[model samples]
Target: MRDPVLKHRARGMRMVPTDAERHLWQYLRNGQLGGWRFRRQHPIPPYILDFVCLEVCLAVEVDGGQHADSGYDEARTAFLKSRGWRVLRFWNNDVLRNPEGVAASVLEALGGVRRADTCPHPDPPPLGGGGN
Candidate 1:
Protein backbone atom coordinates (compact mmCIF):
# COMPACT_ATOMS: atom_id res chain seq x y z
CA MET A 1 0.00 0.00 0.00
CA ARG A 2 2.62 2.52 1.05
CA ASP A 3 4.98 1.42 -1.68
CA PRO A 4 2.48 2.05 -4.44
CA VAL A 5 1.51 5.46 -3.13
CA LEU A 6 5.13 6.49 -2.83
CA LYS A 7 5.93 5.13 -6.27
CA HIS A 8 3.03 7.05 -7.77
CA ARG A 9 4.11 10.31 -6.23
CA ALA A 10 7.73 9.68 -7.14
CA ARG A 11 6.81 9.38 -10.77
CA GLY A 12 4.85 12.59 -10.72
CA MET A 13 7.60 14.41 -8.86
CA ARG A 14 10.16 13.30 -11.39
CA MET A 15 8.32 14.34 -14.53
CA VAL A 16 10.40 17.51 -14.15
CA PRO A 17 10.84 19.45 -11.00
CA THR A 18 9.51 22.92 -11.83
CA ASP A 19 11.91 25.80 -12.41
CA ALA A 20 11.48 26.74 -8.79
CA GLU A 21 12.33 23.29 -7.60
CA ARG A 22 15.42 23.30 -9.75
CA HIS A 23 16.42 26.70 -8.43
CA LEU A 24 15.91 25.66 -4.84
CA TRP A 25 17.61 22.37 -5.52
CA GLN A 26 20.74 24.30 -6.50
CA TYR A 27 21.07 25.53 -2.94
CA LEU A 28 19.80 22.40 -1.21
CA ARG A 29 21.69 19.81 -3.21
CA ASN A 30 25.09 20.96 -1.97
CA GLY A 31 24.42 21.77 1.70
CA GLN A 32 23.89 25.39 0.73
CA LEU A 33 20.64 25.69 2.66
CA GLY A 34 21.66 26.78 6.14
CA GLY A 35 24.74 24.57 5.87
CA TRP A 36 22.67 21.45 6.43
CA ARG A 37 22.69 18.79 3.79
CA PHE A 38 19.36 18.30 2.04
CA ARG A 39 18.22 15.56 -0.27
CA ARG A 40 16.15 16.16 -3.38
CA GLN A 41 13.20 13.91 -4.16
CA HIS A 42 13.73 12.18 -0.85
CA PRO A 43 11.35 9.42 0.20
CA ILE A 44 9.94 9.89 3.65
CA PRO A 45 7.49 7.65 5.51
CA PRO A 46 4.59 7.50 3.09
CA TYR A 47 5.66 10.29 0.76
CA ILE A 48 8.51 11.52 -1.33
CA LEU A 49 9.62 15.02 -0.40
CA ASP A 50 10.77 17.62 -2.92
CA PHE A 51 13.63 18.48 -0.57
CA VAL A 52 14.39 17.34 2.94
CA CYS A 53 16.84 18.09 5.72
CA LEU A 54 16.61 15.03 7.92
CA GLU A 55 18.45 16.66 10.81
CA VAL A 56 15.85 19.39 11.05
CA CYS A 57 12.74 17.40 10.21
CA LEU A 58 12.13 19.83 7.37
CA ALA A 59 10.59 19.11 3.98
CA VAL A 60 10.27 21.63 1.17
CA GLU A 61 7.70 20.98 -1.53
CA VAL A 62 7.71 22.80 -4.83
CA ASP A 63 4.16 22.75 -6.09
CA GLY A 64 3.24 22.96 -9.74
CA GLY A 65 0.12 22.66 -11.86
CA GLN A 66 -0.87 19.23 -10.55
CA HIS A 67 -0.87 20.52 -7.01
CA ALA A 68 -4.26 22.01 -7.78
CA ASP A 69 -5.50 18.74 -6.36
CA SER A 70 -5.69 20.19 -2.89
CA GLY A 71 -7.45 17.18 -1.46
CA TYR A 72 -4.65 14.78 -2.29
CA ASP A 73 -1.94 17.22 -1.32
CA GLU A 74 -3.67 17.83 1.98
CA ALA A 75 -3.84 14.13 2.72
CA ARG A 76 -0.19 13.75 1.86
CA THR A 77 0.76 16.67 4.08
CA ALA A 78 -1.32 15.30 6.93
CA PHE A 79 0.44 11.99 6.69
CA LEU A 80 3.81 13.72 6.78
CA LYS A 81 2.74 15.83 9.73
CA SER A 82 1.76 12.71 11.61
CA ARG A 83 5.32 11.52 11.16
CA GLY A 84 6.77 14.66 12.80
CA TRP A 85 7.95 16.32 9.62
CA ARG A 86 7.43 20.06 8.98
CA VAL A 87 6.48 20.67 5.38
CA LEU A 88 6.92 23.94 3.50
CA ARG A 89 5.33 24.41 0.11
CA PHE A 90 6.29 26.94 -2.54
CA TRP A 91 4.69 27.50 -5.90
CA ASN A 92 6.90 27.02 -8.94
CA ASN A 93 6.45 30.62 -9.92
CA ASP A 94 7.40 31.85 -6.48
CA VAL A 95 10.70 30.08 -6.65
CA LEU A 96 11.54 31.11 -10.17
CA ARG A 97 10.69 34.73 -9.53
CA ASN A 98 12.33 34.95 -6.13
CA PRO A 99 15.05 32.40 -5.69
CA GLU A 100 16.85 34.53 -3.13
CA GLY A 101 13.72 35.04 -1.11
CA VAL A 102 12.94 31.37 -1.37
CA ALA A 103 16.42 30.50 -0.16
CA ALA A 104 16.10 32.98 2.67
CA SER A 105 12.76 31.48 3.65
CA VAL A 106 14.24 28.02 3.72
CA LEU A 107 17.14 29.22 5.83
CA GLU A 108 14.77 30.98 8.16
CA ALA A 109 12.67 27.86 8.48
CA LEU A 110 15.82 25.95 9.41
CA GLY A 111 16.14 27.96 12.64
CA GLY A 112 19.17 29.90 11.41
CA VAL A 113 21.98 27.42 11.53
CA ARG A 114 25.45 28.86 10.88
CA ARG A 115 27.04 28.64 7.46
CA ALA A 116 30.79 27.89 7.24
CA ASP A 117 33.10 30.84 6.73
CA THR A 118 35.19 30.81 3.58
CA CYS A 119 38.38 32.48 4.82
CA PRO A 120 41.22 30.14 5.60
CA HIS A 121 43.04 30.31 8.90
CA PRO A 122 46.83 30.58 9.01
CA ASP A 123 48.58 27.37 9.97
CA PRO A 124 50.26 27.32 13.35
CA PRO A 125 54.03 27.19 13.33
CA PRO A 126 55.57 23.69 13.91
CA LEU A 127 55.83 22.75 17.55
CA GLY A 128 59.65 22.79 17.40
CA GLY A 129 59.63 26.29 15.92
CA GLY A 130 57.48 27.68 18.73
CA GLY A 131 59.23 28.96 21.83
CA ASN A 132 58.55 26.86 24.93
Candidate 2:
Protein backbone atom coordinates (compact mmCIF):
# COMPACT_ATOMS: atom_id res chain seq x y z
CA MET A 1 0.00 0.00 0.00
CA ARG A 2 1.13 3.52 -0.69
CA ASP A 3 1.65 6.02 2.11
CA PRO A 4 -1.18 8.50 2.48
CA VAL A 5 1.14 11.42 3.10
CA LEU A 6 3.11 10.57 0.00
CA LYS A 7 -0.04 10.23 -2.03
CA HIS A 8 -1.17 13.60 -0.77
CA ARG A 9 2.11 15.22 -1.62
CA ALA A 10 2.09 13.67 -5.05
CA ARG A 11 -1.36 15.00 -5.68
CA GLY A 12 -0.66 18.46 -4.24
CA MET A 13 1.79 19.55 -6.88
CA ARG A 14 2.74 18.18 -10.25
CA MET A 15 6.50 18.22 -10.33
CA VAL A 16 7.48 19.30 -13.81
CA PRO A 17 10.77 17.50 -13.89
CA THR A 18 13.56 19.26 -15.70
CA ASP A 19 14.90 18.46 -19.14
CA ALA A 20 17.51 16.19 -17.66
CA GLU A 21 14.84 14.20 -15.92
CA ARG A 22 12.89 13.85 -19.14
CA HIS A 23 16.01 12.71 -20.95
CA LEU A 24 16.88 10.20 -18.30
CA TRP A 25 13.32 9.02 -18.21
CA GLN A 26 13.51 8.22 -21.88
CA TYR A 27 16.20 5.69 -21.11
CA LEU A 28 14.76 4.41 -17.84
CA ARG A 29 11.03 4.43 -18.45
CA ASN A 30 10.76 1.26 -20.52
CA GLY A 31 12.96 -1.14 -18.62
CA GLN A 32 15.88 0.13 -20.65
CA LEU A 33 18.23 -0.07 -17.72
CA GLY A 34 19.13 -3.72 -18.03
CA GLY A 35 15.42 -4.52 -18.09
CA TRP A 36 14.96 -3.00 -14.67
CA ARG A 37 11.86 -0.84 -14.42
CA PHE A 38 12.17 2.56 -12.78
CA ARG A 39 9.62 4.81 -11.18
CA ARG A 40 9.63 8.59 -11.30
CA GLN A 41 8.96 10.74 -8.28
CA HIS A 42 8.52 7.66 -6.19
CA PRO A 43 7.74 7.95 -2.53
CA ILE A 44 9.80 5.57 -0.46
CA PRO A 45 8.80 5.23 3.14
CA PRO A 46 8.93 8.76 4.54
CA TYR A 47 10.61 10.43 1.64
CA ILE A 48 9.77 11.16 -1.98
CA LEU A 49 12.57 10.09 -4.25
CA ASP A 50 13.16 11.49 -7.73
CA PHE A 51 13.55 8.07 -9.26
CA VAL A 52 13.67 4.61 -7.81
CA CYS A 53 14.70 1.19 -9.11
CA LEU A 54 13.03 -1.12 -6.60
CA GLU A 55 14.70 -4.14 -8.11
CA VAL A 56 18.10 -2.92 -6.96
CA CYS A 57 17.18 -0.55 -4.17
CA LEU A 58 18.64 2.25 -6.23
CA ALA A 59 17.54 5.85 -6.07
CA VAL A 60 18.43 8.63 -8.46
CA GLU A 61 18.08 12.30 -7.77
CA VAL A 62 18.59 15.06 -10.28
CA ASP A 63 19.48 18.26 -8.55
CA GLY A 64 19.08 21.81 -9.63
CA GLY A 65 20.47 24.99 -8.07
CA GLN A 66 18.18 24.68 -5.07
CA HIS A 67 20.01 21.57 -3.88
CA ALA A 68 23.03 23.65 -2.97
CA ASP A 69 21.74 23.55 0.59
CA SER A 70 24.28 21.07 1.84
CA GLY A 71 22.56 20.38 5.12
CA TYR A 72 19.28 19.32 3.58
CA ASP A 73 20.79 17.14 0.89
CA GLU A 74 23.13 15.51 3.39
CA ALA A 75 20.30 14.76 5.76
CA ARG A 76 18.21 13.32 2.96
CA THR A 77 21.04 11.13 1.73
CA ALA A 78 21.81 9.97 5.24
CA PHE A 79 18.21 9.05 5.81
CA LEU A 80 17.97 7.11 2.57
CA LYS A 81 21.25 5.29 3.18
CA SER A 82 20.06 4.30 6.60
CA ARG A 83 17.05 2.69 4.97
CA GLY A 84 19.32 0.37 2.94
CA TRP A 85 18.88 2.35 -0.26
CA ARG A 86 21.78 3.57 -2.34
CA VAL A 87 21.28 7.10 -3.59
CA LEU A 88 22.93 8.73 -6.57
CA ARG A 89 22.72 12.42 -7.34
CA PHE A 90 23.52 14.24 -10.53
CA TRP A 91 23.41 17.85 -11.56
CA ASN A 92 20.57 18.57 -13.94
CA ASN A 93 23.05 19.99 -16.40
CA ASP A 94 25.18 16.90 -16.30
CA VAL A 95 22.29 14.72 -17.22
CA LEU A 96 20.96 17.06 -19.87
CA ARG A 97 24.40 17.45 -21.38
CA ASN A 98 25.51 13.86 -21.20
CA PRO A 99 22.87 11.30 -20.44
CA GLU A 100 25.10 8.49 -21.63
CA GLY A 101 27.52 9.08 -18.77
CA VAL A 102 24.69 9.06 -16.29
CA ALA A 103 23.36 5.84 -17.75
CA ALA A 104 26.81 4.31 -17.57
CA SER A 105 27.22 5.22 -13.93
CA VAL A 106 23.83 3.80 -13.02
CA LEU A 107 24.63 0.62 -14.92
CA GLU A 108 27.94 0.36 -13.08
CA ALA A 109 26.27 0.69 -9.72
CA LEU A 110 23.73 -1.93 -10.73
CA GLY A 111 26.53 -4.31 -11.71
CA GLY A 112 27.24 -5.53 -8.19
CA VAL A 113 23.67 -6.69 -7.58
CA ARG A 114 22.52 -7.64 -11.08
CA ARG A 115 21.92 -11.31 -10.50
CA ALA A 116 18.68 -12.99 -11.62
CA ASP A 117 17.51 -12.82 -8.05
CA THR A 118 18.76 -10.87 -5.07
CA CYS A 119 17.83 -13.72 -2.78
CA PRO A 120 20.42 -16.22 -1.59
CA HIS A 121 21.54 -19.17 -3.71
CA PRO A 122 19.69 -22.48 -4.17
CA ASP A 123 17.78 -21.06 -7.07
CA PRO A 124 14.20 -22.03 -7.61
CA PRO A 125 13.06 -23.87 -10.67
CA PRO A 126 11.61 -21.99 -13.62
CA LEU A 127 7.98 -21.04 -13.38
CA GLY A 128 5.41 -22.95 -15.51
CA GLY A 129 6.70 -25.53 -17.99
CA GLY A 130 10.37 -25.01 -18.84
CA GLY A 131 11.76 -25.13 -22.41
CA ASN A 132 9.22 -23.95 -24.95
Candidate 3:
Protein backbone atom coordinates (compact mmCIF):
# COMPACT_ATOMS: atom_id res chain seq x y z
CA MET A 1 0.00 0.00 0.00
CA ARG A 2 1.21 3.47 -0.76
CA ASP A 3 1.78 5.48 2.35
CA PRO A 4 -0.12 8.71 2.82
CA VAL A 5 3.03 10.81 2.78
CA LEU A 6 4.18 9.29 -0.47
CA LYS A 7 0.78 9.78 -2.00
CA HIS A 8 0.84 13.43 -0.97
CA ARG A 9 4.28 13.85 -2.42
CA ALA A 10 3.17 12.35 -5.69
CA ARG A 11 0.28 14.76 -5.94
CA GLY A 12 2.59 17.68 -5.43
CA MET A 13 4.98 16.36 -8.01
CA ARG A 14 2.29 16.27 -10.67
CA MET A 15 1.82 19.98 -10.23
CA VAL A 16 5.50 20.94 -10.35
CA PRO A 17 7.00 18.78 -13.07
CA THR A 18 10.57 19.20 -14.19
CA ASP A 19 11.33 20.42 -17.70
CA ALA A 20 11.87 16.96 -19.11
CA GLU A 21 8.84 15.58 -17.34
CA ARG A 22 6.71 18.42 -18.64
CA HIS A 23 7.82 17.75 -22.20
CA LEU A 24 7.34 14.02 -21.89
CA TRP A 25 3.89 14.41 -20.36
CA GLN A 26 2.56 16.03 -23.50
CA TYR A 27 3.06 12.79 -25.42
CA LEU A 28 1.90 10.62 -22.57
CA ARG A 29 -1.20 12.46 -21.42
CA ASN A 30 -4.44 12.31 -23.47
CA GLY A 31 -3.65 8.94 -25.04
CA GLN A 32 -1.81 10.57 -27.92
CA LEU A 33 0.55 7.66 -28.33
CA GLY A 34 -1.44 4.97 -30.07
CA GLY A 35 -4.19 5.03 -27.48
CA TRP A 36 -1.74 3.89 -24.86
CA ARG A 37 -2.85 5.77 -21.77
CA PHE A 38 -0.11 6.81 -19.39
CA ARG A 39 -0.29 8.18 -15.86
CA ARG A 40 2.07 10.80 -14.55
CA GLN A 41 3.54 10.86 -11.09
CA HIS A 42 1.69 7.72 -10.21
CA PRO A 43 2.34 6.38 -6.77
CA ILE A 44 2.92 2.67 -6.46
CA PRO A 45 3.59 1.18 -3.08
CA PRO A 46 6.76 2.93 -2.00
CA TYR A 47 7.57 4.92 -5.11
CA ILE A 48 6.28 7.38 -7.64
CA LEU A 49 6.82 6.79 -11.34
CA ASP A 50 7.20 9.61 -13.82
CA PHE A 51 5.02 7.91 -16.36
CA VAL A 52 3.25 4.58 -16.22
CA CYS A 53 1.31 2.71 -18.85
CA LEU A 54 -0.53 0.47 -16.45
CA GLU A 55 -2.10 -1.47 -19.29
CA VAL A 56 1.30 -2.91 -20.15
CA CYS A 57 2.89 -2.61 -16.72
CA LEU A 58 5.52 -0.26 -18.03
CA ALA A 59 7.08 2.70 -16.28
CA VAL A 60 9.15 5.41 -17.95
CA GLU A 61 11.49 7.53 -15.91
CA VAL A 62 13.11 10.75 -17.12
CA ASP A 63 16.16 11.38 -15.04
CA GLY A 64 18.62 14.24 -14.96
CA GLY A 65 22.42 13.86 -14.88
CA GLN A 66 22.24 13.78 -11.10
CA HIS A 67 20.84 10.28 -11.23
CA ALA A 68 23.54 8.85 -13.50
CA ASP A 69 25.45 7.22 -10.66
CA SER A 70 22.80 6.92 -7.99
CA GLY A 71 22.40 3.56 -6.32
CA TYR A 72 18.94 4.54 -5.19
CA ASP A 73 17.69 4.49 -8.75
CA GLU A 74 19.24 1.08 -9.25
CA ALA A 75 17.44 -0.23 -6.21
CA ARG A 76 14.23 1.39 -7.38
CA THR A 77 14.52 -0.34 -10.75
CA ALA A 78 15.08 -3.68 -9.10
CA PHE A 79 12.16 -3.16 -6.79
CA LEU A 80 9.84 -2.22 -9.62
CA LYS A 81 10.98 -5.23 -11.65
CA SER A 82 10.41 -7.55 -8.72
CA ARG A 83 6.86 -6.25 -8.70
CA GLY A 84 6.40 -7.19 -12.39
CA TRP A 85 6.81 -3.75 -13.89
CA ARG A 86 9.25 -3.16 -16.72
CA VAL A 87 11.16 0.08 -16.22
CA LEU A 88 12.77 2.39 -18.74
CA ARG A 89 15.00 5.32 -17.97
CA PHE A 90 15.99 8.05 -20.39
CA TRP A 91 18.45 10.82 -19.86
CA ASN A 92 16.77 14.21 -19.54
CA ASN A 93 18.77 15.53 -22.44
CA ASP A 94 17.89 12.53 -24.56
CA VAL A 95 14.19 12.99 -23.97
CA LEU A 96 14.25 16.68 -24.64
CA ARG A 97 16.69 16.33 -27.55
CA ASN A 98 14.83 13.46 -29.20
CA PRO A 99 11.38 12.76 -27.81
CA GLU A 100 10.57 10.78 -30.92
CA GLY A 101 13.25 8.30 -30.03
CA VAL A 102 11.92 8.14 -26.50
CA ALA A 103 8.45 7.60 -27.90
CA ALA A 104 9.79 4.85 -30.13
CA SER A 105 11.43 3.13 -27.21
CA VAL A 106 8.24 3.43 -25.18
CA LEU A 107 6.28 1.90 -28.03
CA GLU A 108 8.68 -1.01 -28.22
CA ALA A 109 8.42 -1.60 -24.52
CA LEU A 110 4.63 -1.46 -24.46
CA GLY A 111 3.93 -4.00 -27.18
CA GLY A 112 7.26 -5.43 -28.25
CA VAL A 113 6.60 -3.55 -31.45
CA ARG A 114 8.74 -0.95 -33.15
CA ARG A 115 7.77 2.10 -35.13
CA ALA A 116 9.78 4.02 -37.64
CA ASP A 117 11.38 7.26 -36.51
CA THR A 118 8.57 9.26 -38.00
CA CYS A 119 5.79 7.58 -36.08
CA PRO A 120 3.36 10.42 -35.92
CA HIS A 121 1.25 11.10 -32.88
CA PRO A 122 -2.24 9.71 -33.09
CA ASP A 123 -4.88 12.48 -33.18
CA PRO A 124 -2.15 14.99 -32.87
CA PRO A 125 -3.00 18.50 -31.86
CA PRO A 126 -1.13 21.51 -33.24
CA LEU A 127 2.29 20.86 -31.74
CA GLY A 128 3.36 24.50 -31.92
CA GLY A 129 5.16 24.05 -35.27
CA GLY A 130 7.34 20.90 -35.21
CA GLY A 131 9.09 20.99 -31.88
CA ASN A 132 8.94 17.96 -29.65
TM-score: which candidate is best?
3
Q: Global lDDT for candidate 1?
A: 0.74
Sort by TM-score, best first.
3, 2, 1
The lowest-lDDT stretch of 10 consecutive residues in candidate 1 is 115-124
Model 3 per-residue lDDT tens digits across residues 94-122: 98999888988887676763322332221
Question: Candidate 2 regions off by >4 Å?
Answer: 11-15, 115-132
Name the candidate, 2 or 3, with the larger TM-score value.
3
Between the candidate structures 1 and 2, which one is better when assessed by TM-score?
A: 2
Model 3 misplacement above 4 A: 113-132
What clash pairs does model 1 have?
none
Task: Give the least accurate 10-residue stretch of model 2, judged by summed lDDT.
Answer: 116-125
- Please say which candidate is ahead in lDDT: 2 or 3: 3
| Model 3: lowest-lDDT 10 consecutive positions | 114-123
lDDT per model vs. reference: 0.74, 0.77, 0.81
Could you tell which candidate, 1 or 3, scores higher by TM-score? 3
TM-score (all chains, Cα) for each model: 0.71, 0.78, 0.81
- Every model's Cα RMSD, please? 13.2, 8.2, 12.6
The lDDT, on a scale of 0 to 1, for candidate 2 is 0.77
